[model samples]
Target: MNNKLIRQAQEALIVLGYLSGTADGKFDKSTQDAVLRFRRAEGLKRTNIISQPLMPYFEAATLKKLQTNLKTLGYANGVTGKLDKATIAAIKTYQKNNKLRQSGEYSHVLLAKTNRAAREREQARNRRAPVSVQNNIGTSSRSNDVVISSRNIPSQSNSSKASAMPNLNNRTVQENEIMRSEPNTAIQGKMRILKGSNGQVTGCKISTITISSDWCTSGNNKEGSQCNVLYKNGRVLSVRCR
Candidate 1:
């Protein structure tokens, strides 16, 4: 699909709660479901029509429904209920799976994919995992997407090691100046860029992001040796160097 349409579809989905990444205008499954779910609930045909294909017949209500969903999902930050950045990020995550769009817009194909993934995710969650002692080490929720090895880790550490961990509490706060303001703003820690399983943490900008959990590395928006995520306080938390 065209980039603009893809972004529109993705934006519509994020406005609905079915996503968790920046809308970069790629039509993925997450976007697809956003369209379908909104349509079905509104008593409309559950099809991919959040685009030129659907036209005026399903445009207005669909957009409204999408916004409503986004608010319901906590992604819609503003009370205005407009499809903003938060909504777009949440939607972009869904599109990641279907391999469609990611430009933070709304479209047809993305709507379809989004709907399908949600249903599948629900089903999978409901299904019981096979009983086995085999290690199925899932990634950490806190470390963005980088997988750290807790395996064989010594539970007991000397005071020196504990003290070695960087303390972010002393960080210089510059709220008025505003850093990490843009979506896809790179995350950097002591070592490098922090990346999620998908790649790097690319999503909405939060007013406050405390580095409570220590990050040796970080995440960024582009491929580079130098960090893309520069801190106003001169601290590079972590950089997303691909």
Candidate 2:
């Protein structure tokens, strides 16, 4: 088979969450492992060898995996391989939820965001660990109970809104206060509060929030105007409120 086909298969495996490394057209160990995982997930024979018939399966599997991820992120998109209205609508809904543009187009960036959301949700659910017999003696049973919240349940919000996070690579923020609490580990770089057309902080970006040690020249970064406020500790957020 052509190396291009292998690269395509690699990209599909990536969309299905079976691969992590880049699709460099080389059938390396990571690519082989991803192929094995994809085959297992699709109920095919567990092998690293790519075949002609399996080519179509790669694309279908990618779409289905994306649909699964979208569902996990609280969108009710259908799992059809075709670019149906339902899937596009779900993409738009996801974009709106993440304060992104409602282009209704599938991109690797959007896939990444959905994957992160799914992983975060999975982590949150995992935090409610099963109760242990040893701890049952000293404390109330309710204290050890695993309570799952419905905060992540999907909603059918309007996807027509034109809200999006500013390109963080191109923009930066001026800060006002230094955070005292431990920062959210997931949140990194400089955080900026994004404002909507009405001048309200509709969303926020994880852009470079420059921190300076000197009191007199704190806002003197070469990137742009800087803020003296430090945000070492603050609430970790995916986006600000609407």
lDDT of 2 at 120: 79
Over 4 Å off, model 1: 1-81, 130-242
TM-scores for all candidates: the values are 0.28, 0.47
Best by TM-score: 2
Model 2: ten consecutive residues of lowest lDDT:
210-219
Clashes of 1: 64
Regions of candidate 2 where Cα sits further than 4 Å from its true position: 45-47, 128-242
| Cα lDDT tens digits for candidate 2, 1-242 | 67988888887777667887788888888988888888888899999998788987876766666676765544542456766887888788778767899999886567767778777766654443221111112222344322222122222234422342223333322222222222323324434444344322222233332111111111121112232333212312222211
